[model samples]
Target: MIKKAPVGEIPFAIAGDSRIYVTAFVNGSDSLRFLVDTGASSIVLNTNSPKLKGLIHNGELADNLGTSGENSVEYSNDNSVKVGTIQYDKAGCAHIPYPPEYWDGVFGLNGLAAFNIEINYDDFKIYCYPKETLTVEDSYVSLPFTYKYDVPFVHLHIKLNGTLHNLLLEVDTGSDRIIDLNTPFVNKNNLLETKKPFAISRIASSDGGSGELKNVFFDEVIVGPYIMPKVAGAFSTLIFGMQSKENIDGMIGNNFLKRFNMLIDFNADKLYLQPNNFYYTPFYDFLVR
Candidate 1:
Protein backbone atom coordinates (compact mmCIF):
# COMPACT_ATOMS: atom_id res chain seq x y z
CA MET A 1 0.00 0.00 0.00
CA ILE A 2 1.87 3.08 -1.28
CA LYS A 3 -0.86 5.26 0.26
CA LYS A 4 0.15 8.73 -0.97
CA ALA A 5 3.17 8.80 -3.22
CA PRO A 6 2.32 11.83 -5.42
CA VAL A 7 5.31 11.53 -7.89
CA GLY A 8 8.11 13.72 -6.56
CA GLU A 9 11.79 14.11 -5.79
CA ILE A 10 13.45 14.11 -2.37
CA PRO A 11 16.92 15.28 -1.49
CA PHE A 12 19.18 13.16 0.71
CA ALA A 13 22.47 13.38 2.56
CA ILE A 14 25.41 11.02 2.79
CA ALA A 15 26.38 10.16 6.34
CA GLY A 16 29.93 9.11 7.31
CA ASP A 17 31.02 8.71 3.66
CA SER A 18 28.52 6.15 2.35
CA ARG A 19 25.12 5.86 4.07
CA ILE A 20 22.37 7.73 2.20
CA TYR A 21 19.44 9.02 4.31
CA VAL A 22 16.57 11.49 4.31
CA THR A 23 14.75 13.38 7.06
CA ALA A 24 11.07 12.72 7.38
CA PHE A 25 8.20 13.59 9.71
CA VAL A 26 7.40 10.69 11.94
CA ASN A 27 3.75 10.64 12.94
CA GLY A 28 3.73 14.46 12.56
CA SER A 29 5.61 14.70 15.79
CA ASP A 30 9.32 14.98 15.00
CA SER A 31 11.55 15.19 11.96
CA LEU A 32 13.70 12.10 11.98
CA ARG A 33 16.41 10.88 9.69
CA PHE A 34 16.32 7.46 8.03
CA LEU A 35 18.82 5.79 5.73
CA VAL A 36 17.23 4.76 2.46
CA ASP A 37 18.36 1.18 2.01
CA THR A 38 17.24 -1.40 -0.49
CA GLY A 39 18.64 -4.28 1.47
CA ALA A 40 16.50 -3.45 4.48
CA SER A 41 13.25 -5.41 4.68
CA SER A 42 11.14 -2.55 5.96
CA ILE A 43 11.27 0.72 7.86
CA VAL A 44 13.14 0.21 11.11
CA LEU A 45 13.19 3.15 13.50
CA ASN A 46 16.13 3.73 15.77
CA THR A 47 15.17 2.49 19.18
CA ASN A 48 17.73 4.92 20.55
CA SER A 49 16.38 8.05 18.90
CA PRO A 50 15.00 10.51 21.48
CA LYS A 51 12.38 11.44 18.93
CA LEU A 52 10.72 8.10 19.61
CA LYS A 53 8.42 10.11 21.83
CA GLY A 54 4.94 10.87 20.42
CA LEU A 55 5.05 7.95 17.97
CA ILE A 56 2.81 5.22 19.27
CA HIS A 57 5.04 2.30 20.08
CA ASN A 58 4.39 -0.82 22.15
CA GLY A 59 6.33 -4.00 21.48
CA GLU A 60 9.52 -5.89 22.11
CA LEU A 61 12.59 -5.09 20.01
CA ALA A 62 13.96 -8.42 18.91
CA ASP A 63 17.42 -9.19 17.53
CA ASN A 64 17.68 -10.53 14.03
CA LEU A 65 20.48 -11.91 11.83
CA GLY A 66 22.47 -9.40 9.79
CA THR A 67 25.70 -8.84 7.84
CA SER A 68 27.74 -7.19 10.57
CA GLY A 69 26.30 -9.93 12.79
CA GLU A 70 23.29 -9.98 15.12
CA ASN A 71 20.64 -7.26 14.78
CA SER A 72 17.70 -6.35 17.04
CA VAL A 73 14.31 -5.20 15.85
CA GLU A 74 10.68 -4.86 17.12
CA TYR A 75 7.62 -4.63 14.96
CA SER A 76 5.06 -1.78 15.17
CA ASN A 77 1.87 -1.16 13.29
CA ASP A 78 -0.35 1.88 12.56
CA ASN A 79 2.25 4.56 12.11
CA SER A 80 2.47 7.51 9.75
CA VAL A 81 5.62 8.33 7.79
CA LYS A 82 5.88 11.44 5.69
CA VAL A 83 8.98 12.38 3.77
CA GLY A 84 9.32 14.61 0.76
CA THR A 85 6.13 14.19 -1.26
CA ILE A 86 5.26 10.74 -0.01
CA GLN A 87 3.05 9.82 2.90
CA TYR A 88 2.60 6.29 4.07
CA ASP A 89 -0.45 5.66 6.17
CA LYS A 90 -0.71 2.53 8.26
CA ALA A 91 3.05 2.28 8.04
CA GLY A 92 4.86 -0.59 9.68
CA CYS A 93 8.43 -0.17 10.95
CA ALA A 94 10.80 -1.87 13.31
CA HIS A 95 12.76 -0.55 16.24
CA ILE A 96 16.40 -1.31 15.71
CA PRO A 97 19.86 0.14 16.24
CA TYR A 98 20.70 1.32 12.75
CA PRO A 99 22.76 4.08 11.10
CA PRO A 100 24.59 4.55 14.44
CA GLU A 101 25.51 7.71 16.32
CA TYR A 102 22.69 10.29 16.05
CA TRP A 103 20.70 9.00 13.07
CA ASP A 104 17.26 7.41 12.97
CA GLY A 105 16.60 4.07 11.22
CA VAL A 106 16.46 2.58 7.74
CA PHE A 107 13.71 3.34 5.22
CA GLY A 108 13.52 0.07 3.32
CA LEU A 109 13.11 0.21 -0.46
CA ASN A 110 10.32 -2.33 -0.06
CA GLY A 111 8.21 0.52 1.27
CA LEU A 112 8.34 2.06 -2.16
CA ALA A 113 7.83 -1.08 -4.20
CA ALA A 114 5.06 0.55 -6.15
CA PHE A 115 7.25 3.27 -7.63
CA ASN A 116 10.20 3.60 -9.95
CA ILE A 117 13.06 5.07 -7.93
CA GLU A 118 15.89 7.17 -9.35
CA ILE A 119 18.97 8.11 -7.41
CA ASN A 120 21.25 10.89 -8.69
CA TYR A 121 24.51 11.25 -6.83
CA ASP A 122 25.44 14.41 -8.71
CA ASP A 123 22.53 16.39 -7.26
CA PHE A 124 21.94 14.19 -4.22
CA LYS A 125 18.32 13.69 -5.11
CA ILE A 126 15.95 10.69 -5.02
CA TYR A 127 13.17 10.82 -7.50
CA CYS A 128 10.05 8.68 -7.18
CA TYR A 129 7.40 8.08 -9.78
CA PRO A 130 4.28 6.00 -10.19
CA LYS A 131 4.93 2.56 -11.60
CA GLU A 132 5.18 2.48 -15.41
CA THR A 133 5.70 6.24 -15.55
CA LEU A 134 9.42 6.29 -16.30
CA THR A 135 10.86 4.97 -19.53
CA VAL A 136 13.92 2.76 -20.03
CA GLU A 137 16.30 2.42 -23.00
CA ASP A 138 19.07 0.21 -24.35
CA SER A 139 21.64 2.94 -23.74
CA TYR A 140 21.32 2.38 -20.03
CA VAL A 141 23.01 -0.79 -18.88
CA SER A 142 19.89 -2.52 -17.70
CA LEU A 143 20.67 -5.16 -15.10
CA PRO A 144 17.93 -7.56 -14.14
CA PHE A 145 17.51 -8.30 -10.43
CA THR A 146 16.03 -11.05 -8.29
CA TYR A 147 14.64 -10.41 -4.85
CA LYS A 148 15.17 -12.33 -1.67
CA TYR A 149 13.23 -11.14 1.36
CA ASP A 150 12.52 -7.83 -0.37
CA VAL A 151 16.18 -7.13 -1.15
CA PRO A 152 17.34 -6.93 -4.74
CA PHE A 153 20.41 -8.68 -6.12
CA VAL A 154 22.28 -8.94 -9.41
CA HIS A 155 25.13 -11.02 -10.82
CA LEU A 156 28.57 -9.47 -11.34
CA HIS A 157 31.65 -10.74 -13.14
CA ILE A 158 34.78 -11.13 -11.07
CA LYS A 159 38.15 -11.89 -12.63
CA LEU A 160 40.71 -13.55 -10.41
CA ASN A 161 44.14 -14.41 -11.80
CA GLY A 162 42.90 -14.44 -15.41
CA THR A 163 39.82 -16.60 -14.69
CA LEU A 164 36.48 -14.86 -14.94
CA HIS A 165 33.46 -15.99 -12.91
CA ASN A 166 29.99 -14.78 -12.05
CA LEU A 167 28.76 -14.16 -8.54
CA LEU A 168 25.42 -12.97 -7.25
CA LEU A 169 25.87 -9.84 -5.15
CA GLU A 170 23.25 -8.04 -3.11
CA VAL A 171 23.02 -4.41 -4.17
CA ASP A 172 23.19 -3.23 -0.61
CA THR A 173 22.91 0.50 -0.01
CA GLY A 174 23.07 -0.14 3.71
CA SER A 175 26.72 -1.16 3.61
CA ASP A 176 29.75 1.11 3.20
CA ARG A 177 31.93 -1.74 1.94
CA ILE A 178 32.86 -2.00 -1.72
CA ILE A 179 32.85 -5.81 -1.93
CA ASP A 180 32.71 -8.54 0.69
CA LEU A 181 33.04 -12.17 -0.37
CA ASN A 182 31.19 -14.66 1.83
CA THR A 183 32.98 -17.52 3.58
CA PRO A 184 31.36 -20.36 1.65
CA PHE A 185 32.05 -18.62 -1.61
CA VAL A 186 35.65 -17.95 -0.62
CA ASN A 187 36.05 -21.50 0.58
CA LYS A 188 34.53 -22.88 -2.59
CA ASN A 189 36.94 -20.84 -4.65
CA ASN A 190 39.84 -21.67 -2.28
CA LEU A 191 40.76 -17.99 -2.49
CA LEU A 192 42.79 -18.01 0.70
CA GLU A 193 45.21 -20.63 -0.64
CA THR A 194 45.40 -19.06 -4.09
CA LYS A 195 45.41 -15.31 -3.55
CA LYS A 196 47.77 -13.15 -1.55
CA PRO A 197 45.87 -11.17 1.06
CA PHE A 198 47.34 -7.74 1.76
CA ALA A 199 45.60 -6.81 4.97
CA ILE A 200 43.11 -7.80 7.68
CA SER A 201 40.47 -5.33 8.92
CA ARG A 202 37.51 -5.31 11.28
CA ILE A 203 34.06 -4.34 10.02
CA ALA A 204 31.43 -3.29 12.57
CA SER A 205 27.69 -2.73 12.64
CA SER A 206 25.39 -0.53 14.72
CA ASP A 207 23.77 -3.53 16.38
CA GLY A 208 27.16 -4.71 17.76
CA GLY A 209 27.98 -7.19 15.02
CA SER A 210 31.69 -7.09 14.12
CA GLY A 211 34.22 -9.35 12.43
CA GLU A 212 37.58 -9.44 10.71
CA LEU A 213 37.87 -9.25 6.92
CA LYS A 214 40.81 -10.48 4.90
CA ASN A 215 41.62 -7.99 2.19
CA VAL A 216 42.59 -9.09 -1.31
CA PHE A 217 42.47 -7.70 -4.81
CA PHE A 218 40.31 -8.78 -7.71
CA ASP A 219 42.21 -8.62 -10.97
CA GLU A 220 39.15 -7.21 -12.63
CA VAL A 221 35.43 -6.65 -11.85
CA ILE A 222 32.85 -6.10 -14.54
CA VAL A 223 29.81 -3.97 -13.72
CA GLY A 224 27.81 -3.99 -16.90
CA PRO A 225 30.28 -2.68 -19.50
CA TYR A 226 32.47 -0.83 -17.01
CA ILE A 227 35.64 -2.51 -15.87
CA MET A 228 37.16 -1.87 -12.45
CA PRO A 229 40.77 -2.98 -12.26
CA LYS A 230 42.55 -4.00 -9.08
CA VAL A 231 39.45 -3.57 -7.03
CA ALA A 232 39.74 -3.99 -3.27
CA GLY A 233 37.97 -7.13 -2.02
CA ALA A 234 37.05 -8.34 1.45
CA PHE A 235 36.68 -11.99 2.30
CA SER A 236 34.38 -12.35 5.26
CA THR A 237 35.07 -14.64 8.20
CA LEU A 238 31.32 -15.43 8.18
CA ILE A 239 30.71 -14.29 11.75
CA PHE A 240 27.81 -12.17 10.57
CA GLY A 241 24.45 -13.80 9.89
CA MET A 242 24.07 -12.61 6.32
CA GLN A 243 27.66 -13.54 5.49
CA SER A 244 27.04 -17.09 6.66
CA LYS A 245 24.13 -17.58 4.30
CA GLU A 246 24.66 -20.01 1.45
CA ASN A 247 23.92 -19.63 -2.26
CA ILE A 248 24.77 -15.89 -2.50
CA ASP A 249 28.41 -15.01 -3.02
CA GLY A 250 28.63 -11.48 -1.53
CA MET A 251 27.42 -7.91 -1.59
CA ILE A 252 28.32 -4.78 -3.61
CA GLY A 253 28.18 -1.88 -1.18
CA ASN A 254 27.48 1.85 -1.36
CA ASN A 255 31.08 2.77 -2.11
CA PHE A 256 30.67 1.10 -5.49
CA LEU A 257 27.00 2.01 -5.88
CA LYS A 258 27.66 5.76 -5.51
CA ARG A 259 29.73 5.75 -8.68
CA PHE A 260 26.60 5.57 -10.82
CA ASN A 261 23.36 7.41 -11.34
CA MET A 262 20.82 4.68 -10.79
CA LEU A 263 17.20 4.01 -11.60
CA ILE A 264 15.49 1.03 -10.01
CA ASP A 265 12.26 -0.07 -11.61
CA PHE A 266 10.48 -2.22 -9.09
CA ASN A 267 7.75 -2.98 -11.59
CA ALA A 268 10.24 -4.32 -14.09
CA ASP A 269 12.67 -5.79 -11.55
CA LYS A 270 15.52 -3.97 -13.27
CA LEU A 271 18.27 -1.59 -12.27
CA TYR A 272 19.65 0.90 -14.78
CA LEU A 273 22.99 2.64 -14.30
CA GLN A 274 25.15 5.36 -15.86
CA PRO A 275 28.51 6.35 -14.49
CA ASN A 276 28.37 9.45 -12.36
CA ASN A 277 31.11 11.92 -11.39
CA PHE A 278 32.31 9.50 -8.74
CA TYR A 279 32.71 6.58 -11.13
CA TYR A 280 36.38 7.15 -11.89
CA THR A 281 37.23 7.83 -8.28
CA PRO A 282 39.28 5.23 -6.49
CA PHE A 283 37.53 2.56 -4.45
CA TYR A 284 37.88 2.76 -0.68
CA ASP A 285 40.60 0.50 0.55
CA PHE A 286 40.65 -1.33 3.88
CA LEU A 287 43.86 0.45 4.88
CA VAL A 288 43.80 3.36 7.29
CA ARG A 289 46.61 5.90 7.22
Candidate 2:
Protein backbone atom coordinates (compact mmCIF):
# COMPACT_ATOMS: atom_id res chain seq x y z
CA MET A 1 0.00 0.00 0.00
CA ILE A 2 1.12 3.51 -0.82
CA LYS A 3 1.58 5.84 2.11
CA LYS A 4 -0.54 9.01 2.11
CA ALA A 5 1.25 12.26 2.73
CA PRO A 6 -0.43 14.96 4.77
CA VAL A 7 -2.14 17.71 2.83
CA GLY A 8 -1.80 21.31 3.91
CA GLU A 9 -3.67 24.55 3.30
CA ILE A 10 -2.24 28.03 3.74
CA PRO A 11 -4.24 31.23 3.83
CA PHE A 12 -3.07 34.08 1.62
CA ALA A 13 -3.72 37.80 1.57
CA ILE A 14 -4.93 39.19 -1.73
CA ALA A 15 -3.83 42.57 -2.92
CA GLY A 16 -6.46 45.03 -4.08
CA ASP A 17 -5.39 44.29 -7.62
CA SER A 18 -5.48 40.47 -7.13
CA ARG A 19 -1.84 39.66 -6.28
CA ILE A 20 -1.60 36.79 -3.82
CA TYR A 21 0.69 36.94 -0.79
CA VAL A 22 1.42 34.25 1.78
CA THR A 23 3.43 34.27 4.99
CA ALA A 24 6.44 31.93 5.29
CA PHE A 25 9.11 31.26 7.88
CA VAL A 26 12.83 31.15 7.23
CA ASN A 27 15.12 29.12 9.55
CA GLY A 28 12.14 28.85 11.92
CA SER A 29 12.65 32.42 13.13
CA ASP A 30 11.76 35.25 10.78
CA SER A 31 8.25 35.34 9.34
CA LEU A 32 8.11 36.97 5.95
CA ARG A 33 5.43 37.63 3.36
CA PHE A 34 6.08 36.13 -0.04
CA LEU A 35 4.23 36.47 -3.34
CA VAL A 36 3.23 33.11 -4.76
CA ASP A 37 4.49 33.40 -8.33
CA THR A 38 4.26 30.49 -10.75
CA GLY A 39 6.16 32.55 -13.29
CA ALA A 40 9.29 32.60 -11.12
CA SER A 41 11.64 29.64 -11.32
CA SER A 42 13.13 29.82 -7.82
CA ILE A 43 12.54 31.06 -4.31
CA VAL A 44 13.56 34.72 -4.20
CA LEU A 45 14.18 36.75 -1.08
CA ASN A 46 14.83 40.45 -0.67
CA THR A 47 18.48 41.26 0.01
CA ASN A 48 17.40 43.76 2.62
CA SER A 49 15.41 41.32 4.72
CA PRO A 50 16.78 40.58 8.21
CA LYS A 51 16.15 36.91 7.57
CA LEU A 52 19.15 36.85 5.27
CA LYS A 53 21.32 36.59 8.37
CA GLY A 54 19.97 33.12 9.03
CA LEU A 55 20.86 31.78 5.57
CA ILE A 56 24.28 30.59 4.44
CA HIS A 57 25.50 32.65 1.50
CA ASN A 58 26.78 30.57 -1.40
CA GLY A 59 28.92 33.41 -2.94
CA GLU A 60 27.56 32.76 -6.43
CA LEU A 61 25.49 35.33 -8.29
CA ALA A 62 22.30 34.22 -10.00
CA ASP A 63 20.89 36.40 -12.73
CA ASN A 64 17.17 36.83 -13.24
CA LEU A 65 15.21 38.77 -15.85
CA GLY A 66 11.59 39.84 -15.90
CA THR A 67 9.41 42.36 -17.71
CA SER A 68 10.87 44.87 -15.19
CA GLY A 69 14.51 44.22 -16.23
CA GLU A 70 17.52 42.05 -15.37
CA ASN A 71 18.78 41.72 -11.79
CA SER A 72 21.84 39.97 -10.34
CA VAL A 73 20.81 37.86 -7.40
CA GLU A 74 22.84 36.44 -4.51
CA TYR A 75 22.49 32.75 -3.82
CA SER A 76 21.90 31.29 -0.34
CA ASN A 77 20.62 28.19 1.41
CA ASP A 78 18.42 27.91 4.48
CA ASN A 79 18.25 25.13 7.01
CA SER A 80 14.50 25.12 7.16
CA VAL A 81 11.82 26.92 5.14
CA LYS A 82 8.26 26.46 6.22
CA VAL A 83 4.89 27.24 4.72
CA GLY A 84 2.13 26.19 7.07
CA THR A 85 2.89 22.64 8.22
CA ILE A 86 5.06 21.73 5.25
CA GLN A 87 8.78 22.32 5.61
CA TYR A 88 11.78 22.02 3.34
CA ASP A 89 15.25 21.43 4.75
CA LYS A 90 18.31 22.90 3.08
CA ALA A 91 16.11 24.97 0.80
CA GLY A 92 17.81 26.99 -1.91
CA CYS A 93 17.04 30.69 -2.03
CA ALA A 94 18.11 33.70 -4.06
CA HIS A 95 18.41 37.17 -2.63
CA ILE A 96 17.25 39.70 -5.17
CA PRO A 97 16.20 43.32 -5.02
CA TYR A 98 13.49 44.21 -2.60
CA PRO A 99 10.05 43.77 -4.07
CA PRO A 100 7.24 46.33 -3.87
CA GLU A 101 6.16 47.51 -0.42
CA TYR A 102 3.49 44.84 -0.10
CA TRP A 103 5.87 41.92 -0.62
CA ASP A 104 9.22 40.93 0.75
CA GLY A 105 10.00 37.86 -1.39
CA VAL A 106 8.64 35.32 -3.81
CA PHE A 107 7.64 31.68 -3.20
CA GLY A 108 8.52 30.22 -6.57
CA LEU A 109 8.50 26.98 -8.54
CA ASN A 110 11.74 25.63 -7.10
CA GLY A 111 9.91 24.97 -3.85
CA LEU A 112 6.38 24.60 -5.19
CA ALA A 113 7.25 21.92 -7.76
CA ALA A 114 7.47 19.28 -5.08
CA PHE A 115 3.70 19.20 -4.65
CA ASN A 116 0.43 19.76 -6.47
CA ILE A 117 -0.78 23.25 -5.62
CA GLU A 118 -4.27 24.67 -5.89
CA ILE A 119 -4.80 28.41 -5.75
CA ASN A 120 -8.29 29.03 -4.46
CA TYR A 121 -8.99 32.58 -5.51
CA ASP A 122 -12.51 32.38 -4.14
CA ASP A 123 -11.37 31.66 -0.58
CA PHE A 124 -7.86 33.21 -0.70
CA LYS A 125 -6.28 29.89 0.32
CA ILE A 126 -3.70 27.57 -1.15
CA TYR A 127 -4.19 23.80 -0.98
CA CYS A 128 -1.08 21.64 -1.30
CA TYR A 129 -0.89 17.88 -1.69
CA PRO A 130 1.83 15.37 -2.41
CA LYS A 131 1.92 14.27 -6.05
CA GLU A 132 0.84 10.73 -5.18
CA THR A 133 -2.33 11.64 -3.25
CA LEU A 134 -3.86 14.49 -5.26
CA THR A 135 -6.95 13.97 -7.36
CA VAL A 136 -9.19 16.28 -9.40
CA GLU A 137 -12.96 16.41 -9.39
CA ASP A 138 -15.20 15.90 -12.43
CA SER A 139 -16.29 19.55 -12.39
CA TYR A 140 -12.80 20.78 -13.17
CA VAL A 141 -11.51 21.25 -16.70
CA SER A 142 -8.15 19.55 -17.09
CA LEU A 143 -5.80 20.86 -19.76
CA PRO A 144 -2.42 19.46 -20.66
CA PHE A 145 0.56 21.81 -20.39
CA THR A 146 4.31 21.83 -20.92
CA TYR A 147 7.07 23.52 -18.95
CA LYS A 148 9.94 25.45 -20.42
CA TYR A 149 12.56 26.91 -18.05
CA ASP A 150 10.26 25.99 -15.16
CA VAL A 151 7.35 28.06 -16.47
CA PRO A 152 4.03 26.43 -17.34
CA PHE A 153 2.57 26.90 -20.83
CA VAL A 154 -0.98 26.04 -21.92
CA HIS A 155 -2.67 25.97 -25.32
CA LEU A 156 -5.43 28.48 -25.99
CA HIS A 157 -7.40 29.37 -29.08
CA ILE A 158 -8.37 32.95 -29.88
CA LYS A 159 -10.84 34.08 -32.51
CA LEU A 160 -9.48 36.95 -34.51
CA ASN A 161 -12.00 38.51 -36.84
CA GLY A 162 -13.65 35.29 -38.07
CA THR A 163 -10.77 32.83 -37.84
CA LEU A 164 -9.79 30.75 -34.82
CA HIS A 165 -6.08 30.10 -34.26
CA ASN A 166 -4.42 27.96 -31.63
CA LEU A 167 -1.62 29.57 -29.62
CA LEU A 168 0.66 28.62 -26.75
CA LEU A 169 0.31 30.86 -23.71
CA GLU A 170 2.33 30.96 -20.49
CA VAL A 171 0.42 30.72 -17.26
CA ASP A 172 1.93 33.73 -15.48
CA THR A 173 0.44 34.64 -12.15
CA GLY A 174 3.14 37.24 -11.62
CA SER A 175 1.81 39.29 -14.53
CA ASP A 176 -0.99 41.68 -13.67
CA ARG A 177 -2.29 42.13 -17.20
CA ILE A 178 -4.97 39.96 -18.80
CA ILE A 179 -2.82 38.85 -21.74
CA ASP A 180 0.35 39.93 -23.53
CA LEU A 181 1.07 38.76 -27.08
CA ASN A 182 4.39 38.91 -28.86
CA THR A 183 4.74 41.00 -31.98
CA PRO A 184 5.67 38.00 -34.10
CA PHE A 185 2.39 36.25 -33.31
CA VAL A 186 0.39 39.41 -33.94
CA ASN A 187 2.03 40.08 -37.32
CA LYS A 188 1.75 36.46 -38.44
CA ASN A 189 -1.97 36.41 -37.70
CA ASN A 190 -2.64 39.90 -39.14
CA LEU A 191 -4.21 40.75 -35.78
CA LEU A 192 -3.78 44.46 -36.44
CA GLU A 193 -6.29 44.27 -39.27
CA THR A 194 -9.11 43.46 -36.90
CA LYS A 195 -11.85 46.05 -36.49
CA LYS A 196 -11.20 46.47 -32.76
CA PRO A 197 -9.59 49.75 -31.76
CA PHE A 198 -6.25 49.64 -29.94
CA ALA A 199 -4.66 52.05 -27.48
CA ILE A 200 -0.95 52.70 -27.11
CA SER A 201 0.41 52.16 -23.60
CA ARG A 202 3.75 51.98 -21.80
CA ILE A 203 4.76 48.57 -20.44
CA ALA A 204 7.38 48.16 -17.72
CA SER A 205 9.45 45.20 -16.60
CA SER A 206 10.25 44.19 -13.02
CA ASP A 207 13.69 45.77 -13.38
CA GLY A 208 12.18 49.12 -14.52
CA GLY A 209 12.78 48.70 -18.25
CA SER A 210 9.95 50.27 -20.23
CA GLY A 211 8.52 49.64 -23.68
CA GLU A 212 5.50 50.55 -25.71
CA LEU A 213 2.57 48.23 -26.35
CA LYS A 214 -0.70 48.42 -28.25
CA ASN A 215 -3.60 47.32 -26.07
CA VAL A 216 -6.61 45.71 -27.73
CA PHE A 217 -9.68 43.73 -26.77
CA PHE A 218 -10.53 40.31 -28.12
CA ASP A 219 -14.14 39.14 -28.47
CA GLU A 220 -13.50 35.47 -27.84
CA VAL A 221 -10.74 33.32 -26.35
CA ILE A 222 -11.26 29.58 -25.86
CA VAL A 223 -9.54 27.57 -23.10
CA GLY A 224 -10.80 24.03 -22.95
CA PRO A 225 -14.60 24.22 -22.57
CA TYR A 226 -14.63 27.80 -21.28
CA ILE A 227 -15.02 30.78 -23.56
CA MET A 228 -13.65 34.08 -22.32
CA PRO A 229 -15.20 36.93 -24.32
CA LYS A 230 -14.40 40.61 -24.46
CA VAL A 231 -10.92 40.04 -23.07
CA ALA A 232 -8.38 42.85 -22.96
CA GLY A 233 -4.82 42.24 -24.12
CA ALA A 234 -1.69 43.99 -25.31
CA PHE A 235 0.68 43.45 -28.22
CA SER A 236 4.36 44.19 -27.77
CA THR A 237 6.90 44.41 -30.55
CA LEU A 238 9.85 44.51 -28.15
CA ILE A 239 11.33 41.12 -27.47
CA PHE A 240 13.40 40.29 -24.40
CA GLY A 241 16.57 38.28 -24.90
CA MET A 242 15.41 35.58 -22.48
CA GLN A 243 12.21 34.96 -24.45
CA SER A 244 14.01 34.10 -27.69
CA LYS A 245 14.35 30.44 -26.73
CA GLU A 246 10.68 30.06 -25.73
CA ASN A 247 8.43 28.91 -28.57
CA ILE A 248 5.38 30.63 -27.15
CA ASP A 249 2.94 33.17 -28.56
CA GLY A 250 1.71 35.01 -25.47
CA MET A 251 1.06 34.93 -21.73
CA ILE A 252 -2.20 34.56 -19.79
CA GLY A 253 -1.97 36.61 -16.61
CA ASN A 254 -3.79 37.17 -13.35
CA ASN A 255 -6.53 39.37 -14.76
CA PHE A 256 -7.91 36.36 -16.61
CA LEU A 257 -6.74 33.58 -14.25
CA LYS A 258 -8.21 35.10 -11.10
CA ARG A 259 -11.59 34.20 -12.51
CA PHE A 260 -10.92 30.56 -11.66
CA ASN A 261 -9.55 28.44 -8.86
CA MET A 262 -6.51 26.80 -10.43
CA LEU A 263 -4.72 23.54 -9.65
CA ILE A 264 -1.32 23.17 -11.29
CA ASP A 265 0.14 19.65 -11.34
CA PHE A 266 3.68 20.01 -12.58
CA ASN A 267 4.39 16.30 -12.23
CA ALA A 268 1.36 15.28 -14.25
CA ASP A 269 1.79 18.17 -16.70
CA LYS A 270 -1.83 19.26 -16.26
CA LEU A 271 -3.62 22.45 -15.37
CA TYR A 272 -7.04 22.13 -13.73
CA LEU A 273 -9.48 25.02 -13.78
CA GLN A 274 -12.66 25.57 -11.78
CA PRO A 275 -14.49 28.85 -12.30
CA ASN A 276 -14.92 30.81 -9.10
CA ASN A 277 -17.05 33.72 -7.93
CA PHE A 278 -14.99 36.15 -9.98
CA TYR A 279 -15.70 34.33 -13.25
CA TYR A 280 -18.13 37.01 -14.43
CA THR A 281 -16.26 39.97 -12.95
CA PRO A 282 -15.49 42.73 -15.43
CA PHE A 283 -11.93 42.80 -16.71
CA TYR A 284 -9.95 45.71 -15.31
CA ASP A 285 -7.69 47.44 -17.80
CA PHE A 286 -5.28 49.02 -15.37
CA LEU A 287 -2.37 49.03 -17.81
CA VAL A 288 -4.30 50.89 -20.51
CA ARG A 289 -5.70 54.37 -20.33
- Give each model's whole-structure lDDT: 0.77, 0.73
Q: How does residue 243 of candidate 1 score in lDDT?
A: 79
With candidate 2 superimposed using the best TM-score fit, by how many Å does residue 223's alpha carbon deviate from the native?
2.1
Per-candidate TM-scores read 0.89, 0.86
Model 1 misplaced stretches (Cα beyond 4 Å) = 1-6, 54-56, 59-63, 68-72, 98-102, 285-289
Q: Candidate 2 clashing pairs?
A: 67-205, 67-206, 68-205, 68-206, 68-207, 68-208, 69-207
Lowest-sum lDDT 10-residue window in model 1: 1-10
lDDT digits (tens) for residues 1-289 of candidate 2: 1124338777887676667788888765578888888888888776666665545355477777665357676777654678866688888887775634646678888878878888888778887777753466777888898986568888889876667878788888876667877667877766776644557767665454666667787768886788987677776666663232236787887878888889887778888888889888777644344
- Give the runs in model 2 whose Cα sits over 4 Å from its true position: 1-6, 49-58, 68-72, 99-102, 192-201, 206-208, 241-246, 285-289
Give one digit per residue, the lDDT tens place, for model 1 in 44-82: 778677777546477666555577666566778777888
Q: In candidate 1, how many Å is residue 59 off? A: 4.1
Candidate 1's C-alpha lDDT? 0.77
